[model samples]
Each structure stands twice: as C-alpha cells, then as structure tokens.
Target: MHMDIEKLVESGSIVNELDYERAMVADRKLRLLAKTNTHFKHLRNKLRNLIVEYEKRVWSNEDAVDAELLAQSDRAQLIIEKERMFLEKRKKIIQARLKDFSLTQAELGLLLGHKSKTHMSELINGIKPFTLQDLVIISKIFKLDIDSLVPKYLSIEKIDRISAVIEEINNPKLSKIKPTLLSAS
Candidate 1:
C-alpha cells in the first residue's frame, strides 16, 4: 500500500507494524532532509515523539495478549513477519548488488518503471509493494533465486481457501495431506 506519509504524520496514529514502519521511514527521511530544510525538523520531532509514545503504549499493553490468543497471533504474526523478512532480505541483496556494480538508483528506477527516486526508495525499503514483473526483473538482473524473493508462508485466509478446495476435489492423496497442511490454520 502507498501510505499517505504526510497524512500519517498529521493524523498521529500508528495502529500496526506497517504503520509504525512507514512512520519510522518518514521520520528518518525527514531527519536527513532537515539538514538542508529547516521545515522538516519540526515534522521529524513530531514523528519521533509519536514513535516513543507508541513504544510506551505497547509496553503497557503486554498483559492484554493472553494465552488463548497466543497461538493464533503467533501463527499470524510469524507469517506476516516472515514476509517482511523476505522483503528485507531482497532489499539488502539488491542494495548490495547496486553498490557492487556501481549502479545508480536512477538506472534501477527507470528499469523498474519507478521514475521517482523517492518511490523507488520506498519500494526498496518494503514500504510499498512491487509488481510481479518488477520482482521478475530484480530476480533476473540480480541473480537472486525466485523462491527466496517471494513469500512462502500461506496466510490464514489462503490456508482456509486451499482447505476448502482440497475438500471439494476429494482426491485421495490431497485428502490425506489436507489436514496436515492446514492444521496450523
């Protein structure tokens, strides 16, 4: 999702991990820009304060998550975190390759159809989604394995959908594996 970064700043809310991450990126960008632009200093401080408040709230709510919800939350969070980790790995590898090859962000941006360096940076930082075609290009150019570049974890919704399909098909082999595959879901 292309988060409205300034809107996020003005609203002063960080509900989830993605929101927190985007806000952090925005805060960092503002900090860097604040060196040249005096206007960004106030914005950076505001976001930094928000992040601190968010951390405090999270610490205070530790007891809210009980044992009953732990399994489900763990499953969901692991899937989500795994996806993020995969993207982070991709970003690092891509960055390393760019530096090693003496490639400019502009050149990569043009190839990926993101003319704006800012948008490219967002994509590189996993703040935005990349199209499948873009991933394909990255894979080909960077020699990164396709499997390592994408999410392998099935979301709960996807697990449920596949379970339903397996039930509908009723193939003996699939039937035998369905319960095992979807047990976590």
Candidate 2:
C-alpha cells in the first residue's frame, strides 16, 4: 500500500478524489515537518559559535586543551559544514522559485524589508542564515501555499510513514464505510 502511494506520487497521477486528497495531505505534512525542524537551524548556529570559541581557545593555549577537545571541535565544525551545504541546496531551490516568478534580488530585498540587494545576496549565498521570520516573509511575498522555500529533507523512514498514512486514508474499504443518513418520514 505504501509503495502504491509512492508510485502514484512519483508518477504524478491524479486519478481520483482520494488520490488528490492523499497528495494534498502528504504535502501538508511535509511542510509542517519542515517548519517543525527549526531547531536544527538553531542548533547549526550554536554549533558554529562553539566551533569559533573552541578555535580561539586552542589558538590562545594549545597546550591546555587535550586531543579529545580538538577532535570534538573538528566534529562540530564538520557538522556545521554539512548543514551549510544542505542550506545551500535549499537556497538554490528558493532562487529557482524566485526566478520562476521573475523576481530580482533588489525586488526581493525590498519585499523582505532589507535595505539593499547585498543583504539579499548574503542570504542567498548562505553567509547569513535565514530565520523563520524570513521564510514567512518570502512565502507571503511569493504567494507560496506551503513552505516551499525551505527544502523538506525526509528520511526513508519518514517517507514510508507518510506513504502509509496516505494509503490508509485512501483505502477503498474505509472509503466505502460511509455514514448512513436516517430519514424521518
């Protein structure tokens, strides 16, 4: 059943009302999940700060810190790098969407309440991480229905769960079990 729904979504089919509803629900779930993962964004910023602090400490007194601390700092830096890469991909998607709407950086900056295009470029280049408020403003400006500006990174298990939910909702047996109306004569 999960596979069927996945196949349907992948095939881009709108066979019936159930299929359409399932697709809509899945998309909504994805958007909600993306929004809920705001913690990751915060965590990335915290990690970046820790990395900088650790680097400064090591530089100030290399002999005081042990190898383990250095190794841990390296790990934190690696995680921050990976998160930046993920954000870069999301930025590209947002840029593509902006292009689709024929929007320029200057225009987007104005819409987002920025002073100039340079600020928008910084956000686009991943120099400045986007806050949730930024995403909301972009969504409003572009008339985006879902959190399409932020990329949804779903795990395999998450995909399976979503597919299962879609299948269960669209199951024919469930659809056939309609409530009967009682008529008073």
lDDT of 1 at 64: 68
RMSD of each: 5.9, 19.3
Could you tell me the TM-score of candidate 1?
0.58
Report residue 95 deviation for candidate 1 (angstroms): 1.1
RMSD of 2: 19.3
Which residue pairs clash within candidate 1?
none
lDDT scores of the candidates, listed in order: 0.67, 0.50
Candidate 2 structure quality by residue, lDDT tens digits, 1-185: 11222344345444432333333333433343335455324433443444344345454586867786555445434334443456556677778878998988778777777875644654665534466688888777667744455534432334346556656789776444322111000
lDDT score for residue 116 of model 2: 59
The residue-by-residue lDDT of candidate 1 on 1-185, one tens digit each, is: 22555566688866654556556666765676667655567667777888888767653577865674455545545555555566677778888988987887778999888898766765675645677788889788888887656655555556668889988998989888765653322
TM-scores for every predicted model: 0.58, 0.44
Worst lDDT 10-window in candidate 2: 176-185
For all candidates, the clash counts are 0, 0
